[model samples]
Target: MLPLWQLTVAEAAAAMDRGDMSAVDLCEAYLARIGALNDGLGAFLTVSADLARIQAAQADARRAAGERGPLLGIPYALKDLFVTAGLRTTAGSRMLADYVPPYDATVYRRLQVAGAVLLGKLNMDEFAMGSSNEFSAYGAVRNPWDRERVAGGSSGGSAAAVAAGLCAFSLGTDTGGSIRLPASFCGVTGFKPSYGRVSRYGMVAFASSLDQAGTLTRTARDAALVMGAIAGQDPLDATSADKVVEGYAAGLSGRLDGLRVGLAIPEAGDAEQAQLLTDARRILEAAGATVEDVRATADEALIVPTYVVLVTAEASANLARYDGIRYGHHVPGDDLAAMLGAGRGQGFGAEVRRRILMGTYVLASGYQDAYYGQACRVRELVRRRLEATLSPEGGLDLIVGPTTAGPAFPLGAKLTDPVAMYRNDIYTIPANLAGLPAISVPAGFSAGPAGPLPLGLQIVGRRWAEATVLRAADAFQARDDSWRRRPVMATSAASA
Candidate 1:
């Protein structure tokens, strides 16, 4: 018998296509693996074993009846932020622990239409507020490679599950660097489509303008398969692009032989980050790709500060609906005011409360221009600069750099310092700010002064250019078989 736990989505699909594996069988195998491993990792908030089996059986029937899609029968998981009708969709906050959505988000609905079998909901930082996944009310997700290290966040669970072979692939939302960062830490492939390329209608709003949904998978090819099924126009989402959804999977077979790859020269041998970028350039060049030195503009460096303003402002507004009155957590109190205050005060985590306060303060009467408004203008400038540099005449297929400043630090490494945690997103923030397609693929493992940990190289492209990004990523990985290796988690008790 084939080791179902070792199968990739593509491999599983081929098995199902050849009748060697049934969708129901694949789903059951995954559910068994998840059951065996998730308790140790805490990667999931909920497991839909029964539901998944039913969906898988239905997929088998469909395939039997000559119906199939690229992802049909593939068992996947969703970051809890994607609201699923009747399924408990907790955004890893106590506020929504028992709250069930009356409807599915467009992404969930579309995946269902694609005949994808959903295994369950994964954990995330509360309201997608933190980078460590430590802020989740459900507890942090442990890295599959090393249980002692975090799996990264807010999409940590999605990435962890895929990395651990618990799911074929998974969907995660990226605002700031949620998807790509987690994928980097977990040593998986994460693709964040150009903003608006995928519908955010059902995705819980974090930073609306910066929020995007993408896939965390084992390979760039698998990311393309999932992206193909999920990307398109939705009448419900005005922000969703109606542009052509080409065959992203087909584009993966294409090469970067004549393509130009941009290597952003970090200031001097700041050796830490500089070395990671240098290694990335070497891999890309070895794959028959051309490289050019490109400097990150001044606006790019301002992404961290700009993101704070825009994300907090939008989060504050988007989170306003969580008062005790509606569907979320409600505190039974003497009066309406007491109820709302108590519910919000107790339900929201410290980081969430902090951002909400900062957001409200910046958008308040006198501070708008000095803060939020100024941030928007800066964001616009940064976007324009990226567009100019990546235009056809700019001679760049994708921009390459380190995914994070470095690898996963020991737990509590940056917990006390918010700015330290924020700086971790430095290499990733520009993509979200510019509204472009970007991905983080495992480059290789690096041994720093401390110890060895995985490294990631980012490939960013112009808007709606996921194809180019994935192609280059695939090329780099092909040039290095070592990047495809998985981490071996030591024998340790799963974190509760």
Candidate 2:
């Protein structure tokens, strides 16, 4: 039998339902695992053990009262970007390191209502920027597979925790591949729902239009269970969609018959990744789905630049409120302007400042139309191209690709080269541009110098088609047991 800490969300829930485990037992198990492993991984910014115990006990009491839900009694963690009442929400930046919110994010509230225990806040890239976890002020989150390699970002900690079994699952925000990239590196399942499918209220803003809330788990079914718990329209967030939320876990029949799966053949820089793409298509085709190669019309070279422009511009606007006068770090000065300047200068990290400067330049008077405006036009073109290709008339139900160019690279390998770092997100950024649903499932492993490193197969679906995406991923996952292979570090942690 699997240890309590290693059980997936669905398995953990079933254990509790069958009286084999109590919510308190589950929470304590996770706390023990975190205490034992978090120092080596640097996955969490905080561990709210006392609060988690309270929540778990409450869940146990609710279970006694006959209440039932998929996430009931499940232990989980957040990406630290979501505001939780009385919990520090740093967004992985020192600028807001000491800031705590007075109210819960809609997503957090929904999970709490569903009886999921909050383990703590996970680490991320400072202000949700950077492809590697190195930008975090707290420190980089190391991949569980190879401690010297990066876990990817800006949701690095979320993916690491799930992969390492520190928690059953974790919540993460995706903007330009933050969730998917990290999940790929960490060897877990990360699902980024269509924009507005999940509420963004109380989440620290990076790129308002591109940012989305999602989940990281060991399996697509676990992601589906958590998605059902947290996804729906929220009155607090104006951007939330009003469409009916489906019971995602209950609907995962894993039958892909008649599904039209499109194999997106972009310029895969790595030969192994290209082969993985071909294998993914073969797997889907064997499951009774129509598979066809679809050439990418949007130039691969344009994705990173356009994403950089739009996100930086939006980030510059969103970060303007952190002048230290409002709530964050305050540096005293003789005048208001001086005080604001000093506070911002001392509070934000180097990467944050670089992005802010680039954003300001792009949005500046003479350059706005030339840079930011052109980027917007390119974004629209990319979105339209995806829409046309995935439309019913186009006969493509889902687009498949490699989540990353290769596998996890060594930490600090590309930190000095921003362009090189930005290219890490090339494959996953298009889905965010189109506001489409996408997921990264553990594909297989690549032999690394230190050990085996995991790779991912990315499946993207049209707007508001999370069910379809989950179904295809679940079917693919069911076809093999490769995802069950644990990282050496994670296996040691589980045994200890």
Worst window of 10 by summed lDDT in candidate 1: 487-496
- lDDT of candidate 1 over 1-496, digit per residue (tens): 5468567777888888888988988888788778778888999899998899899988999999998688899999999999999899889999997989989998889889999999999999998988878889989888777777778888999989988888889999999899999998888988999999999987888899999999999888888888888899989999999899988878775457887888976553356667777777787777778988889542335878999999899999999999967778889988888889899988898889989999999999999999999999999988888888888977787888778766776667777888777777877888899999999998877663444567777889988887889888887777765446766644212311
Off by over 4 Å in 2: 490-496
List pairs with backbone clashes in candidate 2: none
For 2-106, candidate 2 gives per-residue lDDT tens digits of 888878888888888999989999999889889888999999999999999999999999998998888998999999999999999999988997998999999
The TM-score values for the models, in the order shown, are 0.95, 0.98
Residue pair clashes in candidate 1? 40-494
Clash statistics: count for each candidate: 1, 0
- What is the TM-score of candidate 1? 0.95
lDDT of candidate 2 at residue 324, scale 0 to 100: 89
